[model samples]
Target: FIVGTITSGYYSINSYDYLHKLWLRQLIITSFHHALGFLPSYNILSSFILRWLGAHIEDNVKLAEFQQILRFPSNLLNIEHGVTTFGRASLTSFTMTKEGLCYVDEIYLGSDTNLGNGCTIMPGTTLPSKIIVGSLTLVTQKYASAQSNCVLLGIPAREMPFVIPDDTSVINDLSSLNSSSIYSLLFVCLSFFISKYLFIALYLSSPVAVALFIHAILFCAIYQYSILITKRRSHFTYSEVITHQQYFLFKLMSEFSTFIGPYLSGTQLLPFLFRMLGAQIGSDVILPDIRCITDPHLVNIGDYVRLNMGAYIQAHTFEQRILKLAPITVNHRSVLMSNTLILPGATLQGQNHILPWTLVMKDDQLPPNTKWSGVPAKQVP
Candidate 1:
């Protein structure tokens, strides 16, 4: 029964085939990706792996630690060198691994582009060379189309107040910037066991060594599992979105995201963490405080936006047998002051302002550069 159910669900997600597990090459490469892909740039291991996969990584390119950690599995890199100058951070592009058999095409990261920690450059995203993305920023749009020293913040990120990296990027990375090697993790565990005994029987004699080995293995497993979960969670599937059981699982992971997300607040890591959990974020947006994001995928935000404190943002409503989902577009250069409520399909045009305690309900459209306030958010003179 369980096998039948598993196969049926798999078939539903992929119409063409019921059993399309990852191919051998993909599986091996993916394992390595989670285990060691975060190695410092231009290192022999990274170069060797990319060469094996036919990646034409330029000699001038440098990859900082975790430069590709959060990158989706399906996204490939077209590496080149084009930086005008070098800085403290090694031009890091932390792309993680793909999910399912359908991988997206290669994405180009021009030389001299510096991405701060907790920033996500999604698949199909290309940034022009020399752009500086502030930390904790989420970039959904490709900058390869433009060249600027734009600093973006918040969800659905937008270009905001300009501040040089040397001045603003001094905060500690919200998450650990360091990555580990698979071999090192294994060796550490083996040494702990081996040091306690000359042979297998001797090793088993010490309960402390056995316990330590188990703990080490569990830690490694949790870290790798997190990478895997983040990859799958970020890539939305139809079945997961609509099916009640599947949606439950999706919500389950999101609950975990919510727990860790707040700690990343006001840092350069919150946006990346939020994006993986389902929010559609843009460049140079600021999110000092994020309200409840009931369903993040259903939200759409534009550039240069600021969502102030005490805001409640929702994207879905439930009643009877159907669940309704709609996108909320808060356009460019907008601000929602304290205690604002936004509902599904609410479209706020660019350069708009919402006074405190405003409620923008379902399907409401406010014109550009307008000021609104009230229980139902009426335009104010």
Candidate 2:
């Protein structure tokens, strides 16, 4: 009996030690990911850091600033050379089902693959080489057999009719900006430091509510000042090269707003803050998440419009390695449901109801008082 008890105690100690090590590793990885989001450039830094954290990221891979690997064993993640991600791609390596069964698996991205903004790459998924995944796509293991050089779109990300060209234009464009991007990186870091300093100073000297309000106002003022210095413009064509200070500052403001959004959301302060950032937000507009508006300066929201959580209004897109920008208009009394993506130049005429997870394509003009649904958003009764 004494021997059995001793053996049981030894096994328990080993189990505890194993769990403690795992917890510490996960904490370190999470901290790094959070810090990486604030960095202006993530290509080289992200690849190096992720590799150090046990991810198998290959050479010349370009990861977005906000890309994250959720719930690691990050060692299971493997990316081939020349993989690029445009915006935030969530690579989830772990999942639990309703039956309480937990699973962890590998996620593989082949060479020359491009992931669009807000896409989620699920565990056990294997993307082939030269694939272009559309924005907000959910890529699962079911599509593992998909062919290379094809476009994947929609919720489960099935193959589309488009084929990607075998050219180095995107890589070339990205390479050309590396040297020029250093200035933008420095500017972003300086801005972030100043903003944090301002917030800290105010917080230490005043009441919590007052301090937050003053910090937000000051931050917005600084953003506007930078915009003015950069000669803020409303439109940009696809042919234009956008390695400018203004673009970096724009991204900084977007990230800042998103960071503070949860604190100010569902309050009048949210719209007020967005107004200070140059958005034309109207009275009684309900913005549940400020992250919804990617480009506040180019978005015009009308009265009584309700934008649900995860409703993203993207005012820009990249085509053929070029940037294009346009304004988005959400007219009065319109309702956009959760997880809907409104693309550049989309006009939701007054009194429209857009359902959850719908994608309003670029330059679409939805008629008044209509109910829309689907990936490309056609009117549904």
Candidate 3:
């Protein structure tokens, strides 16, 4: 009877092949995202529960119950006194094997930091006081800091130099300037102006010339944004509004602006685009010329930074059916090595050095001039 029932259900599902299959895929992704979300949320909830009851927690931190642990059946995750772990946050210790698989590892949390839901703190990471991290960040490093105030985000984290004012309770408008205003407008105009010039050159030249010119422009923009010093944190302008030429010239430039610059520049462009659309960025600092997959307006990059090659600076991560995006800021003079991953809604404080090929666990802090290395990146003397 059970087999007959199961067969009937299977047939019923198969009856609506295309639509049902799409629905099933969506459902599976959604379920996975929720399951993943539980890891951080569970640990944070545990920490909150103890805090509300006037108890302090310390040690054996595990984000979820279904996750495996040898020594203890229930993961004894704890948040030390005076330390705050926000709800819907997760700590991860999963590593990819040579065979292309992931295995879970242990995770720990330190002092004070405000973590939003769907945040991922990878294995071997530690968070210190006076920090705020946005949602859905993937941190994969052993990060630590004695710095009182810090902000971080990214798969492999980069530290921004600036911190939000403690007295400031909220950021109602993203355009609120932590730095300056005039500089911001200049860079934006400069970026647009450059794109416009390139558009004209390509217009006069052949299609091949257009492609080459775009490549040149993209490279120049990437180098400038990645390594130069500007007042604005992110320099993203919409090509659609920059030119009204309905012909192929405008379209070509728009494609280059939208696709080429972001992907080649090494910074995630979508986040900057969103931020710009919302008018959240009000500073004058500019990032080194880098190629972003999307536009800078979608993401939030911090002031004065160098984002090296192969680094994934994404402002948002797509999980399940939900799109959780955050602004990423690499604060003034902070250095991220090659191939590092910077996730959404993270700020890397200025003058911090992220060693090459290191993973920056989400929202973790590293003190200025501190040398760090390792898989879950750690401080080197």
lDDT leader: 2
Better candidate number, 2 or 3, judged by lDDT? 2
Please, what are the lDDT tens digits per residue for candidate 1 over residues 1-381? 111111101122253332232233334445667345223332334433454444555543334343242222222555655321111122222223344433233455665555543345554566666565543345663433474556554443466566544432211111321232354334444543443233334336668657445533433343344334324433332223333233223333333334444665655455554565457777776776444455555666777777776665666532111235677888889888876667678998888898876767669999999999865568998
* Candidate 3 C-alpha lDDT tens digits along 221-314: 5433432322244332222212223222332345455545555343434334324333243244333334322224344445555555545455
Candidate 2 — worst ten consecutive residues by lDDT sum?
A: 1-10
Give stretches of model 1 more than 4 Å off: 1-255, 289-291, 319-322
Once superposed on the true structure, which residue ranges of model 2 sit more than 4 Å away at CA?
A: 1-43, 65-67, 70-72, 95-101, 163-168, 172-194, 202-217, 225-263, 319-321
Which ranges in model 3 have alpha carbons more than 4 Å from their true place? 1-254, 257-295, 298-304
All-Cα superposition RMSD per candidate: 18.4, 7.0, 16.6
Q: Arrange candidates by lDDT, descending.
A: 2, 1, 3
Q: What C-alpha lDDT, on a 0 to 100 scale, does residue 179 get in candidate 1? A: 39
The global C-alpha lDDT for each of the candidates, from Candidate 1 onward, is 0.49, 0.70, 0.44
Residue-pair clashes, model 2: 0
Per-residue C-alpha lDDT of model 2 across residues 247-308, encoded as one tens digit per residue: 45555455446556688887887888889889998899888866767667888999999988
Better of 1 and 3 by lDDT: 1
